[model samples]
Target: MRTYNIHEAKTHLSRLIEQALKGEGFLIAKAGKPLVKVTALGKPEASSTRRLGFMAGRMRVPDDFNRIGADEVRKLFEDDA
Candidate 1:
């Protein structure tokens, strides 16, 4: 963890950003009061990976999924109205 005054942080923003990229937490101060904290951004997680444990190998795909042509889809829309 590190702290920087407003002027110091403005003057050394690049260094602070480098530190944040390296996973260091930082606090910025304005008029000697803490104003902001900075941390590294997390990498986006995959939806499939997030579905693990509860979703372990339980997906289903019907053969009819590929057989549904555009004409059949249009019929579904016409029947719904």
Candidate 2:
């Protein structure tokens, strides 16, 4: 698209924002008519692989989840007194 008019987008604003962060989007006129369309903002992409179960069955894992607090933690280390 490459338009850049306002004084060549203020003298090539940092190489047109590094070519619009590499996706190459452009258009910023003011006297030639366009207006603004710099681009580059959709960034949600950082998964690096870590989806073991992702909540498999959605919920429910109580097989005494490690002995549901085993007898009040064995009576707080019993010494009964």
Candidate 3:
């Protein structure tokens, strides 16, 4: 995809950032509308940098952390017993 405008995207701003870093996608009209869009900068689907108690002193359980239930966490994860 490609369109360009604003002065041909500022005189081909480095070939539209090398075709939006190679992933490709564009659009930037103006007097005709469709204002902006470039694309190719999306690689963080998700992540909370989790694990390890997920907080507080980073984890080192066994202080009876607390909150056990749901039938003692399904009998401490029993599979068939």
Candidate 4:
């Protein structure tokens, strides 16, 4: 880390940026108090691509899964006289 007064920072802005890109950071000060820290912004992370049926073989469905509750489900909705 390095410290620079306002004038020095302004005079050597380009050099400071180059240093920052190389992973060196510095602080800029006004009246001997640090005003801000200068550093490079890191590259963004890559996003993963989406695929359909990504969990196709990860789980199994029982043979009677769909018809297991058919009759009770119909009685709940039908009116009883």
Candidate 5:
């Protein structure tokens, strides 16, 4: 691991990112105090925006989904099992 001051980090940001993508991570600091880390993301960022409930109509729910195991679970919690 290597530490770079804020100015140096900004100047060499591109090269540092290349190194990070190659699995060599580093830190950026200000006034000798470490501030942030630079590392490779696990996957490429998605360009297309995603809307909430994208799978809303693609999945199914059972009729008993909300009531699954309600009886025995409640008994165990109340120490009455």
Candidate 6:
């Protein structure tokens, strides 16, 4: 854990970021007081690789899914007229 002043942090931002990405976190301070810590982030889950039917067997869709709520919705609006 190393502390860098504001000026040093600004001057070597890229290098600091690289170090953080390599798991070498550091602290940035201002006026000799610590302010923020830099660290690497965990890898993100990939959306493209996610399974689409993750709950396929856990749920079922009614055959009339789309039309199931049509009548009730239409009546609500009709009563407003």
Q: TM-score winner among the candidates?
A: 6
Which sections of candidate 2 miss by over 4 Å? 4-22, 28-34, 45-53, 57-81
- Of the two candidates 1 and 5, the one with more favorable TM-score, higher being better, is 5
Q: Give per-residue CA lDDT, model 6, range 28-67, as digits (tens).
A: 9999999998899887778656789877799989899999
Q: What lDDT score goes with residue 30 in model 5?
A: 97
Q: Per-residue alpha-carbon lDDT of model 1 for 1-81, expressed as tens digits?
A: 778998999999999999999999799988878999999888667763574476557877677887769787779889956
- Residue-wise C-alpha lDDT for candidate 5, range 1-81, written one tens digit per residue: 899999999999999999999999999999999999999988745644566777888999999999999997888899943
The TM-score of candidate 4 is 0.54
Model 5 clashes, total count: 0
TM-score of 5: 0.53
Tell me the tens digit of each residue's lDDT in model 3 across 17-53: 8888888888889886778888877765445545555
1-81 per-residue lDDT for model 2 (tens digits): 778798978987998988888899898989799978888877766664558877889999988799998898898899585
The 10-residue segment of model 4 with minimum total lDDT is 44-53
Clashing pairs in 2: none
TM-score of each: 0.52, 0.29, 0.28, 0.54, 0.53, 0.56
Model 4 residue runs over 4 Å out of place are: 47-81
How do the candidates rank by TM-score, highest first?
Answer: 6, 4, 5, 1, 2, 3
Task: Give the residue spans of candidate 6 off by over 4 A.
Answer: 47-81
Clash count per candidate = 0, 0, 0, 0, 0, 0
Q: Which stretches of candidate 1 lie over 4 Å from their true place?
A: 46-81
Error of 5 at 67 (Å): 56
Candidate 1 local Cα displacement, residue 41, angstroms: 1.0
